[model samples]
Target: MLLLGMAWTLPNTLLGLLLGVAGLARGARTRWQPGELALVFHRYPWGPGGAMTLGNVILNTGASLEVPCRTYACRAGLGTEPPVLLADHEYAHVLQYLVLGPLFLPLYLLCGGIGVRNRFERAADRYAATGRGWWPWPAPRLP
Candidate 1:
């Protein structure tokens, strides 16, 4: 039974490693310029008297602008910085979308086994709605 369990876990471990490598490579190729508004990483659950926090920001100079974000709870007692982890997690989704292009949405739904395509979006909305500085910033108004 132990051997069988190990065999089952091996494939997943290898796949995760491959995905990590791919994400790192993709991140290396992408660059952000100054003065471009982008979403940064924010950690902190929607709880009473929580403060808003952000880790990083995404930016672009040209017309093409995309930011993808997601939220997930970290294991208790880990004591790691939440913003960093959230930034990595959200950026991974954005990277996947960029690398995979249109196919990303479909592939994500298929592989994630989620019933809806907006599952991630919904989660992001809920996180943002908590008012911990998750509010969407409208386009900058011009005078």
Candidate 2:
């Protein structure tokens, strides 16, 4: 991970900065917490639809996303399902970024057209499902 981070220096730094910025913005928009990584809870505001939120987890896009970026997930006024599942799953993506470094996004996009990129989602989901995270056991069932 260290080598990859270094190998992708400029790109990863820019992406990480973007992610960090989003994390700041999201935190300002809602409640932000620090954990295994960063967390934006309550509500997510800032997207193509003027803060449009489709699901629990909102992903950051672009070449700047070569690294793990800020993920917007809701905590309240969203639904009854626990947000921890989303958080855990997202952190798994961070781990993926750590492993793949700059290759994460390109590979993710090439695979995105298929099942919201099932390959990546499955790994994250599986990680969340394991209950090996900071939250509870049994992640929320997703489609």
Give the candidate number with the greatest TM-score. Answer: 2
All candidates: TM-score: 0.26, 0.47
Candidate 2 Cα deviation (angstroms), residue 37: 3.1
RMSD of each predicted structure? 18.3, 10.7
Model 1, span 1-143: residue lDDT tens: 43443343344324433433343433312334222221321221222311111112322222233333233322223333233223333343443333344444455566453322344433433343342322112337899
Q: How many clashes does each candidate structure show, in the order listed?
A: 2, 0
What does candidate 1 score on TM? 0.26
Error of 1 at 63 (Å): 26
Per-residue lDDT value at 28 in model 2: 28
Candidate 2, residues 37-125: lDDT per residue as tens digits? 33232333344321211111233322111233222222223333333345566666655555566666677667662232346655664
- Per-residue lDDT of 87 in model 1: 33
Off by over 4 Å in 2: 1-10, 19-34, 38-43, 48-84, 113-117, 131-143
lDDT winner among the candidates?
A: 2
Local accuracy by lDDT, each model? 0.33, 0.42
Candidate 1: regions farther than 4 A off? 1-84, 113-143
Prediction 2 global C-alpha lDDT: 0.42
